[model samples]
Target: MNKTYDVVIIGGGLLGCTSAYYLCKNTDLNVALIERGMLGMQTSSLAASLVTRGRATRPLIDLCVETFEAVSELEDLLGDKLDFNHVGSMHVAQSVESATAIAKQTEMLRQMGDHPVELTIDQAREKAPWLSIDQADYIVFNPKDGFIDPYRLCAAYMQGAKASGNLDVYQSTEVLELVKDGAKVTTIKTDQGDFVADQIVVAAGPWINTLLQPLGSGAAMAPVRSHYWITATDPLYPVTSPVVILPEAKAYARPEVGGLLFGLRDQVSKWAHPTDLPNSLQGFSFDEDYEGWTALEEAVEPFLEVCPSIGKVDIHHYISGPSGYTPDGKHVIGKAPHLSNVFLASGCCGAGVAISGGVGQSIHDLVTGQTPRIDLTDFAPDRFGDFDPYDEAFLTQCAASRSQKKAG
Candidate 1:
């Protein structure tokens, strides 16, 4: 790294890399990004990578829509195709309550000028015969929804930033601490060396709190276990299959290769601290939590009526990783309270890849002293105030609350 720089961003996940890409492309500031491990191979690479556009709020909807456009143009920006699949996505509701929620979501999408069609069980079954839709009360389909190769997307941003001549990326470099001078962060002490910068943005996923704890700006984000399973290749669910979210089932699936990538939110969220995790994701997972499959089983059992073959499909792989989440189930963004020139963008709630572009742009704008494109009222970094980063009882309660929100 250079002796000093205009900006230094910690963590090379999707948020950091995308922020770097936009910062370099849109500003004249000298920037450097440091990552403790290989870029995008942590929570980002392990993500299901479902790029859906419907959410409970307008800002989130706009965020997802913006990400869609950004991910689409990445190939032109980086000169490489990211294997983006624009098949579509649908939220399948199996009960009266979930169907009501779907109607609300569909109306919200329509109000935002996005077309989302609500299909009856018969219509949904006709569109995808493999769907066990007899038990589904309603299904909402958004044609613009899709998925992408997340790792390639990260590489695309990194490549674009590197070619900009004003950005440098450091991998396998661990940031030891952020040295604050009065109200400002003046130096970043890393394993390689100390580098001073005018500003610092921490997009360190689950490790964000660990960095902030020392600065007294710690927020209430926690690392919760998230996992998805890939089924053995089945001719019924091919690559063209639209992403399906079963709200009543608390499960979602996207076409993966020729099979299906299945995921579920646990009823009681599992929490992990940064100290308990390895620096890299190379050999990290929750395989030791064998009983966790019970939650997955409870969530997916309702899908059997829609697809009786679900029971026979072999478990291809249980893809597991920890994702950052907050008590209110919204991402933590904006300037860090009481810290001069320190901004944070984490707590993605497992949808980091989908909203990454918008998030990155927001961080870039904030760092450059410009107003963010979207409202940040719901995602303020200090909105919930500081909390004990290592308090399992309180953090676990917050994590469990997130699970309740998703299922409710």
Candidate 2:
């Protein structure tokens, strides 16, 4: 293998793979992607894949719009199905605050071509018998929202990048350091020997700072613990049932075959610098708080308001992993703060899968000297200036962003 290339990407997760895909498809630059473990199996796969297009901000909404368009473009260009279920999304509000927000969102969404349908309590239950949201005072539905298989989708991006014959993937090759010279990063010192590239893109998710900290810089995002619960096969989670979002409950649920897949927001946060973060997550502990069980019990009490279902359902699995979140709940993309050759794509804000396309394509545009299709002003990597990402206060601010997110 050559030690030099036009571009070298660190991390084989969804962001890195997507960046490689667009670069290979849109440019002729030879590229290499390095991963510590298998591609896309880390935090990328652990996420509860929810593609909710309607967002709170216009720019975010536009990013979500570009995501759907990119999904179509990927399928059309590769002739491979992505299987993104556009099974609609139901936004349920149990409090006056949430109901007011939902009403406003529905009104705003209608102007943006969203044919949102207002659903009554009985109607919401009819759509998702597995859920008991009689406590909900407001409900709205958008048919364009849905979920996807995270692993398969990540694989597709990697495979498509390889189809160009210009991309090489090195799985299980852990990146050790970024050897910088002057203001540019010239060599990537990995466990599998050093490689050089004219340009480098760091999409290493939570581990991004491990390479940047030595350079006296870091991405302004915290790796918060994101987890979900999976239930055994049951007839209640019908495939036709739309994904339900409960903001006040800080929960969301979608069907997983005959079973149910639900994720709740943890008020508590987990934080660690990449240096302190464990390399393996197979048996890592996230149940630090004793409140988890009680929160689950209290949260499930509402589902039991209409049916005695969720309380008795046997949980088959629990998925927990890192998701990079910013203090302002936005993604951080664009050039690395002070590095001339390094580009960053971090701070997914719990919507990495949902907004991968826009982020990926924007990274491609930046590296190729072409203009990005979306406005990157709000997503500048260096917007926060210099701050200690490992600082407890900073991580807490980042945790606030995750706490505010209720959708999958």
Candidate 3:
């Protein structure tokens, strides 16, 4: 590899890979992506690939819509077919509070180009016979929303970036430290070797704080453990079924393989520093709150009402992993605070897959001195100033924000 490049993106998750792809394709600058482990095997691969277009904020909605457009063209760009299921999605509100929230979101979403069809009980049931719409007072359905195979999408971006011939990827290449001179990054010391870059983007998922701290910049997001369960095959639910998000239940479910995949937003929050995590991705020792089963039971009860067969379905796997979340339930994007030629695209806050393409393009536009399509002032890296990840008070806030539904 060359001693230096025009741009060096840290981490090889979905954000890094997409950013690299866009940076390489859009600009004449040389791009190099460095990953500590095999690419697309961390949070990006493990993310619940839910791509819902109905968001509460205008910026989020714009980003999601942009991401959908980018993802729709991935197959042609990479010369590969990705498993992007455009089966649409539904968000049901069972309680009065949730119903009111849904109504407000629906009105705001319409202003942002998302036409959410408010479905009646019978209409919802007709759309999905498996839905127990008896308890749902309101349902907002977005036909444009869907899910994708996150790993495949990540791989496609990597492959597309490589096909550019100007982009280089270094797998299993750990960045030991980032040596900066004054305001700009000058050298990247890695276990394998040392390299240089004029502009650097830190897109590492959970390990973002570690990389930023060396440059006197740190992430305020807290690393929290998130998990989802896969159930045994249920013939009723197919891949074409719409993904259901139950805000009252603090859970969401969709068809996975031949069964259902469901996740819960437990009230209890477990936080940990990424540097303290186990080294191996296959055997990472993070907190897996089995007690979440209590919350999980309550979370899935609504689905049980619609599909009683779900009660009989045995769980196949309880997948658990870490996700960086901010206290205000927003992502941290844009340039790093007090740093030049350094940009940050971390703190996904659990919607990394949905917004990766927009984040990548926004970062590219920022680095190339072009105006970004969406105004990201709300997602400024230093929005909340410096915060300690180990602070219990801050982490407690982050945990609560994990499932705090966003409604403008």
Expressed as tens digits, the lDDT of each residue in 1-408 for candidate 2 is 538889999988889988998899888999999998989877888779998876766667676776787777778868988999988999988888888877876777798888999998889988988766546778999998898887877888887788765998898898888888899887898888999999999999888988887897788998887767778888888988898888876878888888888877766656655566677655665556432465466445544554467678888777777789888888899999889999998889888888888888889989988888778888998899889877889988888788777655
What TM-score against the true fold does each predicted structure earn? 0.94, 0.91, 0.92
From the highest lDDT down, the ranking of the candidates is 2, 1, 3
Give all candidates' CA lDDT scores.
Answer: 0.80, 0.81, 0.78
Which is superior by lDDT, 1 or 3?
1
Q: Which candidate model has the greater TM-score, 1 or 2?
A: 1
For every candidate in turn, the CA RMSD to the true structure comes to 2.1, 2.6, 2.5
For residues 269-336, write the lDDT of model 3, one tens digit per residue: 56776678654456563545453465466456645666676678788877767788888878888888
Model 3 RMSD vs true structure? 2.5
Ranking by TM-score: 1, 3, 2
Model 3's TM-score against the true structure: 0.92
In candidate 1 the C-alpha lDDT for residue 274 amounts to 64
List the candidate 2 regions with Cα displacement exceeding 4 Å. Answer: 103-112, 135-137, 287-308
TM-score of 1: 0.94
